[model samples]
Target: MTKYLISFEKGAMDHIPEADWPEVGKAARAVCDEAKDAGVFVFADGLRYDDGDVQHAVVDVDGVVTDGPYPESKELIGGVLIVDVPMREEALRWAAKTAAACRCAQDVRKFIDGPNNA
Candidate 1:
């Protein structure tokens, strides 16, 4: 099985009204449940970015740790979902479902196959 990253940027969800958030949450949860039932779900979560619900940390190669997020990034990933599947097409299909649920575009990419993958 290959692991694929399915993600969305924070800006992509800007158009969703604040009142619809709960319904959106339900839809996204449904997709997660379906994926879990299929035995392909590895992990999934929404990032706590607003109101400093979570703090970001950045470490340099010299071991200097700094509070993040990087000032250079124009958009941050707002959510992440990982699925281990046999093919890229299957991953894309899941991405579609996620995009529909979140009402945003999803960025899908495969993890490189290597010893580090395990």
Candidate 2:
């Protein structure tokens, strides 16, 4: 099986109508259910707005953890899903399904080959 990084680009959802947001949530849940039924879902979750937490963090040298996000940026991670699929096609299909359900763009790309990958 292959792992993929499926993400929406920053500002990708701007075109969606406000009235459709609830429907997007419903669609996302449905896709999650479909993934589970297919036995390809590893994990999936939505993210909460954490910009305040990030702004408060102050990291120090020596890789020490501090009070806030390391750096401030306009764009931060929104949410994510991780899935194990038999091939890239399957991963792309899942991403397409997610995009349709969320009513936002979802990009699907293979996880790079690296050490310690299962």
Candidate 1: worst-modelled 10 consecutive residues by lDDT: 47-56
Q: Give the alpha carbon lDDT tens digit for every residue of 1-118 in model 1.
A: 9999999986788899999999999999999999999999999998766676546777889999987776875468899999999999999999999999999999999999988667
**RMSD in order of candidates:** 1.6, 3.3
For every model shown, what is its TM-score relative to the native structure? 0.91, 0.72
lDDT of model 1, residue 73:
52
Please report how far candidate 2 places residue 63 from its true position, in Å.
2.1
Q: Which residue pairs collide, candidate 1?
A: none
Candidate 2 lDDT, 58-117, residue by residue in tens: 446877767544355634545567778878888988988888877677877787666634
Candidate that would win on lDDT: 1
